[model samples]
Target: MLKLKLYSIICRKYKFVQRESIRSNWMKQRKRTTSATSIANINVH
Candidate 1:
């Protein structure tokens, strides 16, 4: 009933937030890796 519907909405919202957080973390990690690689290249030259 109503309670079940409310719980489903809350669950969906929580999942959405979790997905965005994971995506943001992945982007941050990628940026750090790319920066590290560039720095390594610079050191090589």
Candidate 2:
């Protein structure tokens, strides 16, 4: 029973970490795209 509880806790933590990594990656991709678009606008002007 104790082992089952520990396993569940570890699983929860792993899932949380995975979610955080995905969010950070998405944020980075968005930032890159926005910067690229801004640069394009400046070149146009």
Candidate 3:
């Protein structure tokens, strides 16, 4: 019973970490794209 409880807790933590990493990566990509577009707009103007 104790082992099962510990395993579940570990799994939860791992999933949380994975989700956070994915979110950070996505935000970085979005920022890169936005900056690129803004630069292009400035060049056009």
Candidate 4:
């Protein structure tokens, strides 16, 4: 149950980060790079 909760939290956080990344990507491309790195980190871990 605890693991499920953590997973849900991570999913929520990922979505939030994704939306922010998209918004910032319009102004600067750097954010997309960071977002890509974060995705890799998440997938790796």
Candidate 5:
């Protein structure tokens, strides 16, 4: 039973880390896209 509890805790932690990693990667991608669009707009002027 104790081993099962520990396994569940580790699983939850791993899921949390995976979600955070995905979020950070998404933010980085969004920033890059935004900057690229702004540069394109500036070039149009």
Candidate 6:
């Protein structure tokens, strides 16, 4: 019972960290794409 409880706690923490990393990565990608598109638009105009 104790081991199961500990395992669940660890799994939850790991999942939280995994989610945070994914979110940050997504934000970085979004920023990169927006900047690139803006630059492209400036060149076109």
Per-candidate local distance difference test: 0.97, 0.98, 0.98, 0.89, 0.98, 0.98
Candidate 1 C-alpha lDDT tens digits along 1-45: 999999999999999999999999999998989899999999999
Off by over 4 Å in 3: 39-45
Best by TM-score: 5
Comparing 3 with 5 on TM-score, the higher-scoring candidate is 5
Model 6: how far is 12 from its true place, Å? 0.4
RMSD of each: 2.7, 2.6, 2.5, 14.4, 2.5, 2.4
Of candidate 5, the 10-residue stretch with the lowest lDDT total is: 32-41
- The true-structure Cα RMSD of candidate 4 reads 14.4
Against the true structure, candidate 4 reaches a TM-score of 0.56
In candidate 1 the C-alpha lDDT for residue 7 amounts to 100
Clashing pairs in 6: none
**How well is each residue in 9-36 modelled by candidate 6, as lDDT tens digits?**
9999999999999999999999989899
lDDT of 2 by residue, 1-45 (tens): 999999999999999999999999999999999899999999999
> What is candidate 4's lDDT per residue for 1-45, written digit by digit as tens?
999999999999999999998877775876767799899999999
The reply for model 2, stretches above 4 Å from the true place, is: 38-45
Please list the residue runs of candidate 6 whose C-alpha ends up more than 4 Å from where it truly belongs after superposition: 38-45
Model 6 / residue 15 / CA error / Å: 0.7
lDDT for model 3 comes to 0.98
TM-score of each: 0.74, 0.76, 0.76, 0.56, 0.77, 0.74
Question: Local error of candidate 3 at 17, Å?
Answer: 0.2
For model 3, residues 2-43, the per-residue Cα lDDT tens digits are 999999999999999999999999999989998999999999
lDDT of 5 by residue, 1-45 (tens): 999999999999999999999999999999989899999999999
- Which is the better candidate, 4 or 6, if ranked by lDDT? 6
